[model samples]
Target chain A: MLIKKGAEADIYLEPFRNVLHGAGQGKVMVKQRISKRYRIPEMDRQLRVSRTMLEAKLFSDAKRAGVPTPLVYEVDREDTRIVMEFIRGRQVKLILDSLNPGLRRKLCRLIGRYVARLHRAGIVHGDLTTSNMIFTDEGRIYFVDFGLGGYDSSIEARGVDLHLLRRALQSIHFRITDDAYRAVLSGYRREFGKGAGEVIKRAEEIGRRGRYIQKEARACR
Target chain B: MLCLGIEGTAHTFGIGIADSKGKILANVSRVYVPEQGGIHPREAARFHAVNARRVLDEALNVAGIELEDIDLVAFSQGPGLGPVLRTAATAARALAARLGIPIVGVNHCIAHIEIGRLTGRIHDPVTLYVSGGNTQIIAFDAGRYRIFGETLDIPVGNCLDVFAREAGLSHPGGPNVERLARRGRRYIQLPYAVKGMDMSFSGLMTEAVRRYRDGAHLPDVCFSLQETAFAALVEVTERALAHTEKKEVMLTGGVASNMRLRTMLELMADEHRVKFFVPPSEFCRDCGANIAWTGLLAYLHGVRQRLDDTEVRQRWRTDEVDVPWRGK
Candidate 1:
């Protein structure tokens, strides 16, 4: 297994071990080893093992919900990472930046519907952003990195996703987002049905309040 | 040869397809019909998803292309609704996968500017994007699009949408009020909130709604409201032109389709001897030709995304892109 390391863990890209060329099945990127700074050796080992299981479960749920997540081929609870399917796509946002509004909204609406499907399936992508998702050459959006994913039907979790998008739009594009953002909302409502409106409203309010609190905290600093 | 694109950033749901050369094949948008009040995000998202499928099919059918012939699938990536984003991403992914072709994710706002670039015929121009979800003046600088002026509070389109709701207009209140304002006898004076390059619309919206509640005709308020807000936008745009010294100004996004705003900016740009470019209405609103163009650019620049990069993020920053921009 070939390994790639990040701040949190070392991902072992299995299925490509000792291979000198590209694997026709695509790459299986596995996040396997995470270092624990706070726990004793035994406790750290157990924590890593459990988190590996948790991440694997999250990936399974994501796949089941048609989220185009990397399929978890295998997992070693002893390690923090699990081997999974490697997708062949670009970040959806990067693609968006290169296109025009018409296409941008179309893709965004599709993304909206996909996420809605996941939400309907009771999966909350705790960290939803343009960078975390991929758009495959096959036109499939495979959502990767389920480290923070969990099962939640709470409006707050969903709202937080929306809030993150709003902030992302404000911070990322900061241009030509008006109709584009609303289009995303329209897609959301279509997928979630009537309950989405109130939820979105409440989410917006919560987002506003959250920003206000953050601003105050920053001022205090 | 052609690709269908959809946009749902704010209240307006736009559908458009473009050819390989950045030509709009077909474009359509259904503005949100605001209820008793302003737009409800979730309601708007629902409307988009329902209308988007229909629009997508319409565009594909109109262009006489099957799912398989869609050489590449393109969709907006983010800076919008999570649910809505998911909807678009899912549709594109499914379509691409089903067709066994490539899928390209395009940024909603950048597409607007790219379309403007193609239509306006400017080498490098200053952009004033005013819509429901965003309000900013942008200029290309340091291999990235830099913001020169923006709304510190709510977006311009959101402000307009809210005010339009007060005026009994639909979700995308800009056009509704624009139509009604034509017949209104008087133009009331509203606050023009512009500070340096930064602007404010929340206070203006609150006041406009209040005046409407205080017995002002919705039409007059609408006309005056648009004029006030647009005037502020124009001032900042001119300032950007002055600061950047760019001779060409390109107007994109749904708001760019507004004739009054376009005319005002044109005249302002004219005063500075700067040419102003507003794309044809087809390019103004959300559409996919921009995506095709963007995809082409990314592919050309060797910025293809790896398969292991699969992660749906609610936040993606544009400056983070490592690709170097060499303007034409």
Candidate 2:
């Protein structure tokens, strides 16, 4: 496997390619490693192995629930990384930035549905950055990187996940304001049912309280 | 031996006396209310100039301890408003010099933890220290307090106070919000931002004001706002305990007096099977009693500062102490 290194972890891209050689025609990618330092060799090995196992489990769980996530090809716990299907298109951020408002709205609604599907399966994406989502060449959206993911049914957790997405959309697609964000909420409600509305409402409450605090502090200062 | 601690941090001037043990013989505080807004350093200092002696004398009288009975003098060193800190430093140096006693400068945050230990006896508990001036989740490591998590921007109480103003509430906004929140429903939804162990309140505050302007019920909005913000704090505190594997949690600082916040922390502790310790209302707020009690410990352990060693620091962190660790 050819390993690609980033600032935080190493990514092995060749494992999926080699696995697909037997299938004759397919492209795959792998992101199965977390960097370790300071721990003893044995502890590092254990941490990496456990993290890889968690990632693989998270991937399969999301896939079984029909969430559009990368297909896990192979997981090597000892090496602390996994190989998965290679996404062909760029991050949703790039597309959202370059597209017109209409396309941007469409993409946000699509992303909203995808997120709702994941949360419905009781999985909370701890990190929901724009960079963590990819837009396929065929216009499909795929969620990636379950490194900080976990299972939780708390409305707060789900709300926080959606909040991150909303913030990401607003920050990344700066042109889109509350109206577009509400559209994303509508998409979440449509997919996740009435529960999404309650969750979104709660998320809005959190956002409001946060803003009041800041404005007040500034005014006081 | 008797120890006297002076705390002139933020807008409060606290005076306390403690014995060799952690028993607080007396504790007194003088509060400064800025006419226009938040704590103004110069104005607060002026208030302290006039009121410090009154509070100190009252505390001494309440404790029934004379100036000669004070064997050790302590003062809050930093992580507070500079003008307030100078007022405290000046008092401690003067007292220590006149009384011929050693002075020990204590970190205000650490004093909170130590006082929590005294009041609730959670020796190695994770601490959620939230006040108008500071917000942090702390654990004892390597002899000093280590910050496990903290607000990325404003402190929680300050955030609450800010929102209170937007709601047209009083200056010390937390208690006022809690008072008015009971009348509100949980309908007005807001954002809850907990990024890893760290949290942020800026976005949520902005959204809350917008919703209020749009005619959201003020009471319901206040209730929901407190619920979400307190919930975020609970989540972060729980995460810190889980991460550190500590089974005891301590809540400290001025905001600790809020019943709603206490209830939230209590529930989280219950869910995690961790014992939660909250100091009595007096110790919970910004007071010199905690400082006095904590200084007593340092004095017992032979830690002392010369009379001339009274240097006021505006940003002294709790983790900067060079003490030896005593594990649980």
Q: What share of the true interface contacts does candidate 1 keep?
A: 0.00
iRMS per model, in Å, is: 22.4, 13.2
All candidates' lDDT scores? 0.66, 0.75
Residue-wise C-alpha lDDT for candidate 1, range B143-221, written one tens digit per residue? 6776666675677776776677766766557778788767666666566655435567878899889989999887777
Q: Per-residue lDDT for A1-221 in model 1, tens only?
A: 54433323565665554322354444577676555332224434644676578878988886777667887777876545577777767877677667778878877777677668778888776556565678888777777766556677888667766765655555455574566668778888898896787668866875455212322232233
Q: Candidate 2, after superposition: displacement of residue B53 in Å? A: 1.3
Ten residues in sequence with the least summed lDDT for candidate 2 chain B: B319-328
User: Please, what are the lDDT tens digits per residue for candidate 2 over residues A98-129?
Assistant: 77878777877876777788889998876676
lDDT of 2 at B205: 83
Whole-model alpha-carbon lDDT for candidate 1: 0.66
lDDT per residue (tens digit) for residues B1-328 in model 2: 8989998888788999988766788999989998865767778889988998899889989998778888888899876777778889899988988987788988888888888887776778999999887888887754556666667567888888878888788777888888888897555657666664568876788888888888888887788778777777776776567556788988988889888888878866776677988888888888888888878887777676776666876656565665432532
Off by over 4 Å in 1: A1-221, B1-6, B12-15, B26-36, B51-53, B169-172, B180-189, B216-220, B306-328
**What does DockQ give for each predicted structure?**
0.01, 0.04
